[model samples]
Target: MNRTSNPGDNQTGTSQRPFRVTEDELERALRETLAGRVAAPQPLAADPAAVALRRARRSGRRRALSGLALAGVATVLVTAGMAQLGEPGGNHGTPTVVLGDPRGFSPAPLPTATAPAPGPVRAELDLILGSRLETSGGEQQELTNVGPVERAQRLPDAGGWLMTSATPAGRTLWWLPPNGSPPQVLLAGADAVAVAANGRQVAWRDGPDLHAAGLVGGQLIAANQTPAPAGAEPVGFAGDAVLIRQPGRGGFATWSRSAGARPGPTAPNVLAVYGELPDGRVVGLVAAGKPGRPCVALLDPARDLSPVRTGCGPELAVDGLGAISWDQRWLLLNGAGKAALLIDLRTLGTTVTAHPAGPPVVAGVAWTQTGVAMHVDATGGLVRVRPDRVLDGERPTASTIDGVAPADRPVVVADAGA
Candidate 1:
C-alpha cells in the first residue's frame, strides 16, 4: 500500500525511489510484488481448495493481530521497508508501464501516478510478457527510465518464465528468446493465446478478434473468426483454430480451421480440450461421465489421434509436459519429480538423470525455456540448472547453448555463462 516515485522522475531538484517493505506487511508486499511480476495476476479461483489453503496459511497470523494493536506497532517498520525498495543500493532496472489486471476483474479507477517499483533484484533484462519498451531483471536500487509498455495477451500456465508481447500495430510479436538472440516478433494475435518454442510459432489476441497463422516464411497469414452458431462462446484456441462451447450440449467444436469436422468421431459428451504445447503439439484431457475420473491423452492430428493412449493414471505429474507436447516427440518421462526427464527433443530420446542427485522439486518442474533453463524449488535459495551446466550460484558458468529466462518473473539467478 506504500508508493515510491518513478526512479528517474527527477526534474529540477526532486529525486524518486522505490517502496521499502516491512515485516508486518511482508505477506501483502510479497503477494503484491508477485502479482506485479506476472503479466496479469491470476484470478483467485473460486473453489474450496484455493480458499482452504489460504485460510489455513493465514489463521495464526490473523489470530495474533488483535484489532489495530499490531498496526500501531508496525507503522515505522512499514515505512522503512518502502524506503528500502528505493534505497540507492539494490539493482536498478529500466522502466516499464505495468498494466494491473485484477482477477474477477472489474474496471477500477486509474491512479494519477504509476506504482513505484522496488530496486531490481535481478538484471535489467526483458523477461516479462507485457514489458514493452523496457528492461527488467538483473539489478535493484538503481533508478529506472520509464516508458510505455504493452502486452496484447498474457498466460501463466504455459510454464517457465514466459509471456507474449505484441507491437503497437498489433502485427509483430516478440517472444522471449531461449538463445541469445532478440525476442521473435511475428504478426500473430488471435483467440486464446499460442506460443511455440522449438519451431517458434505464436498467436494471441488483439482487440476482440483473433489473428492467426502469422509470420510464416516471412509473411503473415491472417484469419478472422466468422461468428459462431449464435450461442457458442470461445473456450480454447490451438494454432489457427478455436474450440467453441456449444449451447445446451456438452460439446466443443473447432471453428475456422474447420479442417477437422465438428463432433468428429469423438462424442460430444466424451470430448477432450486440446491446448497447444511449447513444441507445437496438441494436448487435452478426455473427460468422462464420472466427474472425478478424467484421463490424459496425447493427441496428434497429423497422426491417427484416435486417443493414442488413455488412463495415464493419477500418478501423472502436474507439471508434466502437456500430453500434446509429449506427443510431439518421444521423450523419456521418469515419472518421479519435475526434473526426472532428461529429454533430447531432436533425437526424441531420453538422457536420464537430468537432476544432480538432490532433494525433490517441491515446486513444479518450473522451466524457463523448453529445456534450456531449469530450477529445483527449495526453501532457501533453490538450485537452478541450465543447459550444458549446473549453477548453484556458488558457481556461475555460461554455456554455448542459449538459456531461457527463468520464469515470467525474471532470471533472478543465472549461471555465469547464461
Candidate 2:
C-alpha cells in the first residue's frame, strides 16, 4: 500500500499551514466553537503536526487575552486615582507624603474664624452755657438758668445730662434728655446725686435722708428712702449700693436696699473718689494730710477697700478735677499747673503730661466717647490728646476742634449706653 505524505508534516515534526485562514475568520470560528453554535469535528486519527499547531494557536490566544486584561486593570486603577485627587481646576497641588522621624513629626493646626472688633462709640460735643446748652451740631435747649451751673455731667449711658445748679430756694438736681425734652427736676433741694455707671439706678441725698430709685425711660421710679448721716453726699454706686461720703469722716459708707447703711472702706487715706472702673474698682485720691501730695489709687470695694495700685507724681496733683475714660483704662488729671496728666491705670507708673497751646491754662478736662482726652484751654480751644500714643512716653500734640470758639467750652456727650 502506498501512503501519501501529509503536507503539514515538517522535518522537525512541527506544525505547518496547509490552508490559509484570515485572522477575522479564525477569531469568528473560535467564538462560535466556544458559544456551542458550531461544532468542532474530531478526526478519526489525530495528526501530530495538526495537534501541535492547534496547541500553539491556543497558547498565543491566551497570551493576548492576558495582556489585554492587564491593560484594562491598569486603566481602571489610573481613573480611580485621578478621582481621589479632586477636581482639576482647584487650589490643590500635588500630594506629598513625608515620613519624618517619629519624634519630630507634628500635624499642623486647622484654621479658625474670628469675629470683628466693634467700632468706637459715637459722641457729640455740648457747648454748655449759663442759661442754655447747645450741641456742636446746632441743637439747642434752654436750662433752668439757676445761677451759673455748678456741676454738669453726661450720663454714663448717654441717656441724658445731669446738672446741679443753685436756685434761690436751694441747690437743685436736674435731668435733661438727649431728645431735647424739657428739663425735669429730680430733686428741688437735692444736695448730691449719683447715678450708677450702668445708668440703671440713681441715688440722691436730700437733707438727712438718702433717696434711691430706678431710672427707666428718663423717669425715676420705685423710690426708696433711708435715714443717712446729715451732710452725707452720694459719690457713686457700688453695685446696687450707694457709696456715700461721710461729712466728718474722711472715708466712704455704703447703703443699699438690702443693707440700709454700713461703713465702707476703712482705709483712712482715701481723699476723693473719681469714678468706678469696669471691674467694680473705684479710682480715687489717697493722701496722708490736708493739701498733702496725693496719689492716684485703685481701691477695691469688694476687698474691704484695699489699695490695688497707687501712682504719685507732681503731675498727678489733681485739683479735684479729673475724668476717667469709658473703658476705665485711662485717667485724666488736671494738675495745679497749666498741664494735665494722662495716666494709664494698667501701668500705674506710665504718665503723659499734656500742655495746651496758645495759653498755659487748662480750664477743664474730659474723655470723649472715641477715647480721646479733651480739654479746654484759656483760649476756649478744644484740645484733643490721644492717650495711646502719649502713653508710650512720646510728646503729645494738641489739635483744635473746628467751629468751636475760644469763649465756648466743648464737652463730649458720653454715649456709654449702647
Candidate 3:
C-alpha cells in the first residue's frame, strides 16, 4: 500500500515539471541493474506459492501505477490492491454487460478510487453473430443495437468498450459505456487496425495514423501520423510508447511520443506479440518445431538482445493476447485434437486438459478468481480449469457454461468494483 511519486514531482519551483517515464528507460535500467549485480536474494517470509499468487494479484496495480505521460494527456493510474468494501444491498459478485441491444445497464458507483480488480475477471466475446459482453454465468447482452462488428476490446476498467464496425467505405471506431448511453464515434478510417490498451490509455491504428485516448472517456488525446514501415502494424502500448511490428520481423520496435520510432528487442521467428507482461516482459510465440509436433517457444521480454525462451511445445499455441493467464506463468495453448494445453512457466512443463464429452476446440482462455476458464468452440460453453491439476497431468474436470459459445476474440476484463 506504500505509494511514492516520481522524483520529478518533488522539484521546488514555481513551474512544475511533468511526470514522464518511458518503456525504453525502464527496460534499459532493468538490463543494466541485472548485469552489474549477482547477489543472493532474500528469502520470502511466506509460502512461495502464496507469494506468487500475491504478485499475480498485484500485477494489474503495478501496470496502472507505471503508466507514462504522453503529449500532455494526464494518464489515469489506479492501484489494484485496495480493500473490497462492499455497498449495502449491492451484488458484489460477477455482473454482465451485453452489446448490440437496446437493453440499458445502470452505471453502478465505481470502486472507491482504487486499482482495478484482480480476480473474477470480466470478458467480452466478439463473435460472428454479434458482440456479447458478459461475466461468467452472468446475464448475456449484445454490444449495441447497431449492426454486427468484427472487433471489440473491453476497457481495462470494465466500465466501457471500444468497437470497430466495417462498412462499404471503411471502418469506424465507436465507444459505448455501460450506462445505456448512446454510442459515440471516435473516428472512421479506411482500415480499422489493431488496438492496444493499458489501464488509462488506449492506442489504436486508424488508417495510417495511430490514435491514443483516455480509456474511460474515449476522448482523442494524442495521434501519431508517422507512416509505419511498409507493412508494420501496431501490437500494443508499452508505457506511453506504441509497439509496432512488420509482417516478417521477429522483434518489435517502439514508437514514443517524443522520439518518433526506435527499434525494440527482437526474437527469432516471432509469430505474434501478446503485449507486455505486468513485469515488463514482452511475451511472444517463437517457432520451435519438433517434426510434426507443431511446437512454439514462449519468449518473455528481455533486457538483452536475446529473450529467455521459457517453454516450447505444439500445445503452446500462442494465440497472442487471449490465451495468457493473469500471472504470466500459465499459457492456454491449443491442445493436440480436442483439448487445451496449459503450460506452466515456472516449471517449463506442459499439460493437456481435454474433456471426455464436450467440444473439440478451445477458442479462448482466461484466469478467474477460482481457477482457469476456457471457451469451448464446439459446444459454445465456458470451461473452468484447475492449473494445479492440469500441471499434475491429471484429467482436470471442467465446468461447462451453458448458452455461451466460444468467443472469436475473447478478452478478459477485471471488474473494477462496479
Query: For this target, which candidate reaches the highest TM-score against the unseen true structure?
Result: 2
- Order by TM-score, highest first: 2, 3, 1
Query: Which candidate has the top score in lDDT?
Result: 2
lDDT by candidate, in order shown: 0.38, 0.64, 0.51
- Span of ten consecutive residues with least summed lDDT in model 1: 139-148
| Deviation from truth (RMSD, Å), model 3 | 41.6
Candidate 3, 175: how far from true, in Å?
Answer: 1.6
What's the lDDT for residue 385 in model 2? 68
- List runs of model 3 lying over 4 Å from the truth: 1-142, 156-158, 166-171, 197-199, 248-252, 257-259, 262-268, 288-305, 313-322, 335-338, 349-364, 376-379, 389-418
Q: State which candidate, 1 or 3, has the greater TM-score.
A: 3
List per-candidate RMSD values in Å. Answer: 37.7, 19.9, 41.6
TM-score of each: 0.34, 0.57, 0.53
Residue-wise lDDT of candidate 2 within 231-255, one digit each (tens)? Answer: 7778778777677786654666667
Give the lDDT ranking, best first: 2, 3, 1
Cα lDDT for residue 346, candidate 1: 37
lDDT of candidate 3?
Answer: 0.51
